[model samples]
Target: NAVDLGAVLEQFSLVFCRLKFIFGPMALHALDLVDLRSVLHITSPCGRSTYQVTGSSGKTYTCYKSCHYCSCPAFIFSVLRKNDSMLCKHILAVYLSQAMGACQELSVSDQQMCDILLAKDG
Candidate 1:
């Protein structure tokens, strides 16, 4: 006999909803990839290196190789979700791509976060 499973999933959804409500929404950055790249160029500690961010909005945002962080709500969400070191994929990509000039502090921070997660899991 087949059993209906919809109700079981509904309970999980309720739990998730409650978690979200308590957390007051997941942290997420709202900035576009283009603007994030620009900010990285202007604020990157390594000076400047030209790069381009092709946004889903079809507008290309140009900046230096140092661009990181979306400067958007997604950034916070990413952090809350622990999806990435930062909320913006562009920022994570920049860090991953620009190894030579990437921020050591960010690397350390990532390692620490990983360690914390691992410890919690174990």
Candidate 2:
């Protein structure tokens, strides 16, 4: 059976573009099934504005609320590369946790914690 290369390429391009729009510019096909389940844990030792997200992959990434930045590959390759404001699943999970008040808050110094809170509020 002969494969139609042009047709295949076109289909692939369409799917890629759709995924890019949905999951930012990163080629995160594996993350298509990502959701709150993809996040293993959330910790904020500094404050609410700074989060440490542990994904299902067991890798921890830093997320900043002030700038909506995540140190994950998806964010680095997609959001930062494309200059997009979209957040990755891990960051989204953090937002969800925050909304539900489920994030495990860690202890921080009074000054630093106050600074972070002020920064977030202000």
Candidate 3:
């Protein structure tokens, strides 16, 4: 038996909406603002599949593209633990950056990551 992919996607959308409600409006709003150019992607020397994303707030979070994993709380609690395939804002931002060819890629050893972290701490 063939399954209707559209229907499946629609169901997923409903679940996403419900999850968003449970999480609160902040997450949804963040997702909406993900298209901003301020999102930065830092590449790892190990490979290009993993990145560290610096959002418009200047806070950095790690994103593993291969596993759709992010270190952000939204991804941890709302997506990973819930087994939701829908990405959080940071992940979505990275995807948007890649799709728009706007991501600034820097080598892992460039100290950009340290700079971002220190800036966040201050």
- The top-ranked prediction according to TM-score is 3
Q: lDDT tens string, model 2, 21-47? A: 765633353343233344333234543
Better of 2 and 3 by TM-score: 3
Per residue, candidate 1 scores C-alpha lDDT tens digits across 1-122 of 12457777788588657634543333112123323442222222333233334444544333234334343344457654666543354454344335434322222243343343231211
Q: Which ten residues in a row have the lowest lDDT in candidate 1?
A: 25-34
> What lDDT does model 2 reach?
0.58
Each candidate structure's TM-score, on Cα atoms with residue i matched to residue i, is 0.26, 0.49, 0.52
Q: Model 1 compared with the native: what TM-score? A: 0.26
Off by more than 4 A, model 1: 1-52, 59-68, 80-86, 100-122
For lDDT, candidate 2 versus 3, the one ahead is 3
Query: TM-score of model 2 relative to the true fold?
Result: 0.49
From the highest TM-score down, the ranking of the candidates is 3, 2, 1
Clash number by candidate, in order = 15, 0, 0
| Top candidate when judged by lDDT against the true structure | 3
lDDT of 2 at 14: 95
Mark the regions of model 3 whose C-alpha exceeds 4 Å error after superposition.
Answer: 1-35, 44-49, 83-85, 110-122
